[model samples]
Target: MIRYPAYAKVNIFLKITGMRGDYHTLSSRFMRVKNLFDTLWFEPKSTPEFEIRGNFDCDVRSNTIYKAYKHLLAATRSDKLSEWMETHAVCVDKRIPSFAGLGGGSSDAATFLRMCNERLELGLGVEELAEIGANVGADVPFFVYGYESANVTGIGEVVERFDEPLLDFEVVTPQIQISTPAVYRYYREHLYAPIGAEETARLESTPSRTILASMTPTEANDLYGAALGCYRELNEKEGWFFSGSGSSFFRIKDEE
Candidate 1:
C-alpha cells in the first residue's frame, strides 16, 4: 500500500502571451501551498476499483487519478501490469476544491503518477513522467516535476524551477465553478492581445513578488475582467485577486 499527498498550488503571476492553434500560450509563476492538499491511497488488489471521498463531486470513472493509471499502463505496454492495475484499488480523499483554478485535479493526477513509479519500481525519471503527464493536463507536468516553485510556460510544458521568497497568503473559494474553457473563450473575444517582446522580457526577468507588487490591473489576470464581470461580487471583495481561471481568489497576508 502507498499513500501520498497531492498539494494545492497558487498562480502568483499569469500572463496570456498569445494563442497556439486552439490553445492559449501562458507564462506564469506557480507555488505549491503547504497547508492545502488531498490524500490518495493505493492498495494492490486482485480486482480493480477506485473511489473518491471528501469534497469531490465528480464522476469516479472520469477522475484524473483513474485516467493517470490507465495512461501509465498504456505507457508501460505491459498486458500483465495492466491486468494487475485493473485489480488495484485506489482511493482519494479530496481536500482541494475542484474547478477553483488551484490545480487540484492536475495535482492528483501528477501525484498518482509519482506513486505508481515508486511503488511499481518503474525507473521512469521526472522528465519522463512529466512528459506523460502533459498528455493529461497542462499543469500536470509542473507537479510531476516536483518543484516548490517554477516559472511555467508554453501551455505549461515548460517548467523552469526557481526558489521563491517565503510569503504568507490566504485563498478564498466562492461557491461557484468557472469552466476553464469558458474563461479562455471569453478572454479571446474580449481581451486577446499580443504581448510585446519587451513586455515578455520584463516579465521573465522580474521576481514574482516584484511583479505582484507592481502588476497593473490588466496584467494581474488576463481572464480577471471576464471572471469578475460574471461574478460581480468578486469585485466587491478587497485585497483579493483571481487565481487562474478562478472561482477562487487569494490575498497575500500582511507581514508585520
Candidate 2:
C-alpha cells in the first residue's frame, strides 16, 4: 500500500498578460502547503479501479485521479495493466474544497500520475509525466516539478523551476464565493484598465531575488480586485487574499 499527501497550493502572484486563441497567457508564482492536503491511498488490487471518499462535492466520474489514470494508461501502452481484472485501487480522501480554484483537482491528478509511475516502475521522466499531466489540467505540471516555488507559464505546461525554496507561508480560505468563469467574462465586457503596462514593466524588471524578498501578504494575490468585485465577503476580511481566479483566499505565514 502507498499513501501520499496531496498538498494544496496558492498563487503568490498572478498576472493575466493577454489571451491567446485557445489559451490565457499568465505570469505567476506558486507556493505549496505542509499541513493542509487531500489524502490518497493506492492499494494493490487484481484490477484497475478508483474510489474516492471524503467530503468532496463533485462528480466522481470526472475526478482528477481517474483522468490521470486514463491518460497515463494511454501514453504508456500498458494495456496489460488494464487487461488485468485490476492492479490498483485509488482511494481519495477529499479534504480540499472543489471549484474554489484551490487546484485540488489538479493536485489530485498530479499525485495520481506520480504514484502510478512509481508503482508500475514506468520510469517516466519529469518532462514525460508533466506532458501527460498537462493533458489532464493546466496546473498539474507544477506538482510534477516537486519544487516549493516556481515561475509558471505556457498554458501552465512550461515551468521554470525556482532556485530557492519559497519562504514559510500560511494560506486561509474565506467563506465567500466567486465564479472563475464569471470573473473573466465580466472583465472581458468591462475591460477595467489592463494590468497597467507600466506596472507590468516594473514588475518584470525587478530582480527575481529582490521580488521574493519584497513581496508581502497583501501583494500576494493578484486576483484580489476581480474576486472582491465578484464576491463582497472579501472586503470585510483583514488579511485574506484571493487564490487563483476566485472564491478562496490566502495569507503568507512567517515560518517554513
Candidate 3:
C-alpha cells in the first residue's frame, strides 16, 4: 500500500488581476499548511469497480478524486490505470476542512494525479501533470507543482515557484458558509474595483510577512469584500488576512 499526504494550503495574499470569461484571474501567494493535511492510499479490495472510501458528503460524480481519475485516464488512455483500480481501492483519511478556503479538495485531486503518475510510471513531467490537474480545478495546478510557496496567476493556470522561508501560519475557519462562485458573483455585480497593474506587481514582489503587517484583511484579499457582501455574517475578518474566496483566515504563527 502506497500512502501519500494531500497537504492543505492558505493564500497568504490573493489579489484579483482580471477576468477570463466567467472566472476571475488572480495573482496570489499560495503557502502550504505543512502541519495540516489529508492522507491517501490504495488498499487491497476485491471490488470490481472504482471504490473510494472517505468522509465525502458528495457523490462519486461530484468528487474531485474521481474527476482526477477520469481525466488521467482520458489523458493517458492507459488500460493499466483501470486495471490497477480493479484490484485496489482508493482510501482517503481526510483532515482538512472542506469549503474552508484551505484547498483541501484541490490538494486531494492533485495528490491523486501525482500518485497515479508515480505508481503507473506514466512518464509525465511536472508540467504535464500540472496541465492535467488544471482540467480538474483551478487550484489543482498549484498542488500539482507541490511547491512550498508559489505565485499562482492567470486563472490559476500559471504557477511560478517563489523563494521564501516557509513560515508557520495560524489557520482558522469560521462556520459561516461561503462559496467561491457566490463571492465572485457578488463582487462582479456589487463591488468590483480591481487594483492597477503597477500596484499588483509591487504586492506580488513584496514578502508575505510585510504585507500581513502593512495591509488590513480587506486590503490583502480582493475577494474579502465580495465574501462579506455575499454573506453578511462575515463583515469583519477581525483585521486578519483572508484566504481564497471566504470563510478562512490566517496569519504568521505567533505574530502579533
Candidate 4:
C-alpha cells in the first residue's frame, strides 16, 4: 500500500481572457498551500474497485479518483495491463473542502494518476501523466506536475513555472456552496469582457506581491460580481476575496 498527499491550491490572480466555444479562457497564477491537503491510500486488490472514506459528501464511483483510474486504465488498453490494473483498490481520506475553489477534486485525480503510474509501472512520464490528467480535469495537470507556483493560461492547459516564496494564508468557506458552472453562466450573461493584449501584458508583468497588495474588490476575481450576487456576505468581508468560482474566500496573512 502507498499513501499520497493531494495538496490544495489558491489562485493568486485570476482573469477571464475570453471564451473558447462554451468554455471560458483564463490567465491565472496558482499557488499550492502545504497546510491543506487530502490524503489517499492505494492498496492492491484482486479486482479493480474504488472506495472513498472521509468527510466528503459524494458518490464513491463519481469521485474524480475513480474516474482518473478508469481513464488511465483505458489509456493503457492492454489485456495484461488491464487485468493487472483492475486488481487495485483506492481509499481516499479527504481533507480539502470541495467547491471552495481549492482544486481539491482536481488534486485528488492528479495524485491518483501519479500513484497508479508508479505502482503499476506504467512507464508514463510527467508530460504523459499531465496529458492524462488534463483529460480528467483542467486543474489536474497542474497538480500532476507538482509545481509550487505557476502562471497558468489558455483555459488551464498552458503552465509556466516561476519563482515565488511559499505563502501563509487563511481560507474560510461559507455554509453556502456555489456552483462553478452557475458562476460562469452569470459571467457570460452579465459581465463578459474581451481582455486585450495590453491588459494581459500588464497583468503578466505585475509582480505577485504587487497583485496581492493591490487586490481591490474589482480586480481580485473576474467572477466576483456573480459570486457576490449569490452570497452577499462575501461583499461584507474585509480582506477576503473569492477563490475561483467560489463559496470559499481567502486572504494572505503574515506568517507567525
Candidate 5:
C-alpha cells in the first residue's frame, strides 16, 4: 500500500508574454502553499480503476491523477507501474478551493507522478518526468520539480530557479469558475490578435521583476478585461486581478 501527499501552489505573478506556434509563452512566479492539498492512495489491483473522493467535482478517470499514472506506465513499461497502479483509490483531502485558479489540480497530478515513479522505481529523469507530466497537463511539471520559487515559461515546462526572496501574499476568489479551455476559446473566437513581434520582443527583454515593479497594484492582471466580459460579476470588484485567465480574482496583500 502507498499514499502520497499532493501539495497545492499559487501563482505569485502570471503573465502571458507571447504565443508560440505550438504553445503559449508565459512569465510567472509560483509558490507552494501549506494550506491546501489532496491525498492519493494506491494499492495492488487486478484491473485499473481510479476512484476520486473529496471536494472535487471532476470525473476520476479524466482527472490528471489517473492520466499521470497511465503516462508513467506507458513510459516506464514496468508491470508494477501498471499492476499496483491499477484500481487505486484517490481519497482527495481537497482543501484548495476549486475554480480559485490556484493550480490545485495540476499540483495533485504532479505529486502523484513523483510518488508513483519512486514507488515503482521507474528511474525516470526530471526532464522525462516533466515531459510525461506535460502530456498530463501544462502545469504538472512545476510540481514535479518542487521549488520554493521559479520563473516559469513555455507552457509551464521551462522553469528557471528564482534567486529573489519569497514574497508573502493573500489570494481571494469570487464565486466563479472559468475553465482554461473556455477562456482560450473565448480569446480565439472574439479577441484574437496577430502576434505583435515588436511588443513581444520588448516585453521579453525586460526582466519580469522590472516590469512588475513599474505596475501599480490596481493595474495588475492583463486578462481581467476579457475575463470580466466572460463573467460579468468581475466588474463589481474595485481592484481585483484575474488569476490565469480566470473567474478567480485576487489582490496580493503583503503579510504584515
Candidate 6:
C-alpha cells in the first residue's frame, strides 16, 4: 500500500468576498503546515463493504472520503475504482483535528481522491480532481492542487498558487467541535459585510507573510467574529490568528 500525507493548512488570511447565491464566496490564503498531517493508505478490506479505518466520530456514509469516492464514481464510472475498493480499505491515521478550521476532512478527502486516481489509473488531472473535490468540501481543492501556498477564492473553487515564503506554523485546536455551516449561517444572517472587488484584488495580490505582519486576527479572517458569536467557547488570545471558520488558532512558529 502506498501512503500519502494529507497535510493540514492554516488560513494566513480569509476574507468574505460577497455571496454567490447561498454560498459565501471567500478570498483566503491557504498555507500548509509542514509538520502536521494525516496519513492515508490502502489496506486489505476486512469485511464485505468499503471500509475506512480512522478516528472519526461520523459513520462511514457520512465521511467526506466516502463522499469523494461516490463523486469520483459518478464523474467517471471506473470499474477499476469499484473493483479495487471491494478488496482494499481506505485507511487513515489522522493527526489533524477535525472541524477545527484546519481542513483535516477536506485534506483527507482530497488525498483519497488522489490515491484513487493514481491507484486505479483514473487519468484525472489536478483540475478534474479538484472539481470532484469541490463537491466534497470547499477546502478540498486547495489540497488537490497541493501548493505550498495559494489564494483560494470563489466559494472555494478558484485556486491560484501564491509565491509566498513558507513559514512553520504552530497550531492550537481546542477540543471544541465547530460546525462550519452553522458559523456561515450565523454570518450570513447577522454579520455579513462582504468586501468589494478592489479590496478583493488587493488581498489576492498581497503575500501572506506581509498580511500576517499587517493584520490582526479579526482582520485576517472574516469568519472569526461570526465563529466566536456562534460558538461562545471560542476565544481570542493576544497574538494568535484564526484559521478558516473557528476553533483553531495559529501563529508563526518562532514568534515570541
Alpha-carbon lDDT, every model: 0.79, 0.69, 0.87, 0.79, 0.65, 0.91
Largest lDDT belongs to which candidate? 6
- Cα lDDT tens digits, model 6, 1-256, are 7899999999998888887888888989999999999999999875669899989989999999999999999999988898888989988998998888999999999999999999888899999999999999999999999999999999898999998789999999888999889999998899889888998889889887788889999988989999989888777888999989868999998887
Tens-digit lDDT track of model 1 for 1-256: 5579898888877888888999999888888877788888766555455544445677877788777877877788756556656767667788889999899999999998998788767888999899889888899999998888888988999999877674566888988888889888878887787576687667777776677688754467777877766666655355566788887777676721
Clashing pairs in 4: 48-86
In candidate 3 the C-alpha lDDT for residue 220 amounts to: 80
Predicted structure 4, TM vs. truth: 0.91
Which portions of model 6 show Cα errors greater than 4 Å?
A: none
TM match of model 2 to true structure: 0.83
Worst 10 residues of 4 by lDDT: 46-55
Query: Which portions of model 2 show Cα errors greater than 4 Å?
Result: 44-49, 83-87, 192-222, 233-236
Q: List ranges where model 1 is wrong by over 4 Å.
A: 44-46, 49-55, 79-84, 216-218
TM-score of each: 0.91, 0.83, 0.97, 0.91, 0.80, 0.97
Tens digits of lDDT, candidate 4, 173-227: 7777778888888888988885777877777767666788887745867887877
Q: What is the lDDT of residue 223 in candidate 6?
A: 90
Question: How accurate locally is residue 183 in candidate 5, as Cα lDDT from 0 to 100?
Answer: 62
Residue-level lDDT tens digits of model 5 in 157-215: 88766665544445676778776766665655665553355654554454434545665
Over the stretch 1-256, how does candidate 2's per-residue lDDT look in tens digits? 6688887877767777677774566677666766668888765565444555556666667777778878888898886446531655677788777767678889988998887777667889989999999999888999877777777765688787666555545556656556777777655555434455676556654544455456653464445566666666656355545568756666556532
For residues 1-256, write the lDDT of model 3, one tens digit per residue: 8799999998888887778888888889998999889999988898777889999978977999999999999999998898988887889999988888999999999999999889989889999999999999999999999999998989999999988888788888888767888888888898778667998789778877787889888878888888887887875757567889868888887877
Using TM-score as the measure, what is the rank order of every candidate, best first? 6, 3, 4, 1, 2, 5
lDDT of 1: 0.79
Please state the error at residue 9 of candidate 3 in Å.
Answer: 1.0
TM-score of 5: 0.80
**TM-score computed on alpha carbons, candidate 1:** 0.91
